[model samples]
Target: MWASILIASFGTYVEKLVGYLLPHHMLERESIRRMTGLLPVSMLAALVAVQTFAVDQTLAIDARLFGLGVAVVALLLRAPFLVVIIVAATSTAFVRWLGWLP
Candidate 1:
């Protein structure tokens, strides 16, 4: 386990080092810029989907889906970030408290 951790740490360091060593012109290219900009959003969406719908390697239909729905509605209504988060959490908790979902 320690060897794996050290290997991973070194790999991460090398990745960052390569990023820093890349040519300025290559980094500034239009395709690279566009891809970099969209990468985080796509990655975040994938993460959220996985977290909301997966439980112990199986698909789940639970309070999280309702929470996600509430959050999306809040976002569409231009709610503040804090408000959206609070609302989603409250809704999920309410559903769980009511024994509607586990």
Candidate 2:
């Protein structure tokens, strides 16, 4: 067990070290940087869209769609971040509880 743990720890450390010590210029060209910057928003949008529209692994509009709309409006209005999260979550939960989801 100890030997296994040591090997795993060493492997993990080496992988992390390689990641940290790799040349940034090699990994982060202009196009790569632009793509990286866009990635988070795109990923978030995909997640939100999927969650809003997915039911039992099939596509169907649901309460999460309204929640996302409210979230967007809250973001546009510069509402407090916590308030927006709370409002979105509560609104979505309420909508779900209303049995409007199908």
Candidate 3:
């Protein structure tokens, strides 16, 4: 586990270092700029997918997925960020309390 963690951390550091060392002109390309702008959203989406669906390397849906759904609805309604988080957590807890999920 420690070896894997170290390798992943080192790889990420190398990737960032390479980015930093790349030519400014290359980094300034429109396509590169567009991808950089979208990187955060892509990372967040991946995070959400991993958290919502994966457990012990297996896909398993539970309160988290439901909470995400509630959060999505709240977002669609233009709810505040705090409200979105509160609603998602509350819904998750409520579902768990009701034994609706394992």
Instruction: Pull out the clashing pairs in model 3.
Output: none
Assess every candidate by TM-score: 0.74, 0.65, 0.71
Which candidate, 2 or 3, has the higher TM-score? 3
- Per-residue lDDT of candidate 3, residues 1-102 (tens digit): 999999999999997898789778977899988998999999999998998899988999899999999999999999999999999999999999999985
Please give the CA lDDT of all the candidate structures: 0.94, 0.85, 0.93
Q: Arrange candidates, best TM-score first.
A: 1, 3, 2
Model 3 residue runs over 4 Å out of place are 1-26
Compute the lDDT of residue 89 as modeled in candidate 1: 97
- Please write out the lDDT profile of model 2 over residues 1-102, one tens digit for every residue: 999999999998996796589987865689977997898999998987787788777887777788888899999999999989998988888888987753
TM-score-wise, the better of 1 and 3 is 1
TM-score for candidate 1, residues paired by index: 0.74
Q: What TM-score does candidate 3 get on C-alpha atoms?
A: 0.71
Candidate 2's displacement at residue 14, Å, is: 9.0
Report the error of model 3 at residue 84, Å: 0.4
| Regions of model 2 farther than 4 Å from truth | 1-20, 97-102
* Candidate 2 colliding pairs: none
RMSD of 1: 3.4
